[model samples]
Target: MAALRKKPRSPFWFACFTLPDGRRVQRSTKETTRKAAQAKADGWEKLSKERAKARQAHRVIADIYKSAHNKELPDATPRAFITAWLTRRQGELAPASYAAYSGRATHFLSWLEAAADGPMADLETRHFTAYRDALAARVSASTANHGIKLLRVILEDARRDNFIADNPAKDCGLLKQETDTARRPFTLVELRSLMGAADEEWRSMLMFGLYTGQRLGDLARLTWANVDLQAGEIHLRTAKTKRFIRVPICTPLMEHIEGLPAGDDPKAPLHPRAATSKQVTVSRQFGELMAVAGLRAAVNHDASKKGRGSRRAVSELSFHSLRHTATSMMKNAGVSPAVVQDIIGHDSAEMNAQYTHIESKTKRDALDKMPNLLKP
Candidate 1:
């Protein structure tokens, strides 16, 4: 039985109830009227009684199973399992990694609910394949492949935990990615033109990119402490790889660094605006700079006609091209592949090969070194 009562000096009514175990619970009904308070109390009492009965039944069944097998079975719907798994992973993974996992899992579960019309335990390989194909149609193949990879990881964990009989995403193949459309290396002429056109901060960043071959994100967040003018080297820990590298400063870069105003704080970013602004904002500003330099055409999208997916098409030449330019120039200048790899901090030979661009002249010169046994 439940009773409705009002606390002294309080307008709202309270619902007081006792469970089958004689545990009393009191909760504010949040109602001022006696009739409404009585109705709420009655509802609470009914819900408590039903819960008590369910618990009692569950305990009786557990006791029987325990007497027979001495084990408790794990039971949860797909949604419940995934939600709990994601919560556990939130503490284990990096912020960015957790966000990616959460987004993909949430989206897939929503789709699963509509497509399978049942718990996640009933999912099959065909369903995952269908989902992958659907995603590939909606987004780029690379993006679709990322979703598939994430789903495979989630299902593999589920299988390991005995939550699911098998991993449906195990056999699901990644969509075939299209040929890479990565940015090309900027020509020497174009590099010179860009440096001439850039303002002070942009010019400094361009020099750093050309000299260090570091990513934009890493260079933008560079601090005064990282620059060792005495040793003529810059020590950087890459943001993506977390690899610490020491790159010797070139004469040009040194001159530029010397020209900048000295800062008292070693922790202060060398380029304040680049460090503070969002990445997209900086990229867009760089695109505008490209337009100003006549390297790329200016784009104007109509506000009224723009759709949600509409975006400015990527320019052939952008800030990232500076990295390629650095790699290519070093190779062209007769620098050994091993030395270039060390300077650029490439982890593997394969990745270094992708960045290296040997000119026709350089290739021909290397060919000339071969013995003239063919002529003999």
Candidate 2:
């Protein structure tokens, strides 16, 4: 019911009424007479009622669509649907992938704020466009583009399940990757300098990276159980790719391993501190090592802070660059392309993208021919 009340010392009556959305608000009728004020209030209330009824009518149309199609319509909001989807993907996606997907999804929900509470079907392309642009402005193009790609995949799954009629993110193309920050393989001289500057564990890690072309995360988490001394191989399932590969233990790596005393527990980490360290921690430590070797300048905290909200400069050399170096050195050694591809390459086949069905002997031959990193 609409009611008329006087404000502080006003002669005019104010009409207080509830909107269709359930918010109570006051509006001045500008009428001093009671009769005129009551009439205006009644008229406003009637209009709000009509609007509420119209909203209900649209809801009925949804029910009608479901009845006509013999299927139930999805009533989940963006938050609800995205949360459930992430829960379902926990087991399906790799740890790194799930972490990334969850982070981006969470970020999207935060960005949406109140809109996240709306129906999943209500999302439009503008939402994705705004999000992509915002992310790009705050982060790097590669990061924003990767998030967009992941969001597209998530929404496409939603569309297939009838949560949405179409994927709004389908049209949001990825940004161009900034090639200036692209990582390059380390030169042999740079590699030698880094090795000389590093401690025992870091030196071993570099050797593994240069010989096996494995990522820093994988190397940091390696245990004795992952090594087969007799078989001359290092068995590991890569953290990011979830690809199980048996990397041949090169002569230099074998020599390095042979000098170390074996541990009783197979589960014991080869590098105790590194095994427990987070990937970023290991990376930062390596960055410090790079500074010591004069391969890169010391990290400046103030400069890094000043660069917030913008893409910070990335060095062309890092621990991961050793993977590129290993690949480059193998090719330069005249190893066959097919053999090199099998050794450090990902399978292009979508279904078996995590599995490489290459011969062990061929990969071993490729590693044997790789120029010795320690000698030169």
Which candidate's lDDT is highest? Answer: 2
Q: What is the C-alpha RMSD of each candidate to the true structure, in Å?
A: 20.9, 14.6
Quantify all predictions' global Cα lDDT against the true fold. 0.72, 0.80
Tens-digit per-residue lDDT, 1-376, candidate 1? 5788889999999999974444687889999999999898998898767655654554566456657886543333456667788988898886546777888889888887754333444566777898898776656677778998988998899778755555778878887766664579988677767777888899888878877888888898899999888877799998667788887776667667888987799999999999998665787888878888889877654574332234334455778887777777777777666566666667886756765543433333332332221121
- TM-scores of the models, in the given order? 0.60, 0.71
- Residue 250 lDDT, candidate 2, scale 0-100: 73
Which runs of model 2 end up more than 4 angstroms from their true locations?
1-75, 240-242, 280-304, 348-365, 368-376
Q: Which sections of candidate 1 miss by over 4 Å? A: 1-118, 122-139, 196-199, 278-318, 349-376
How well does candidate 2 match the true structure, expressed as C-alpha RMSD?
14.6
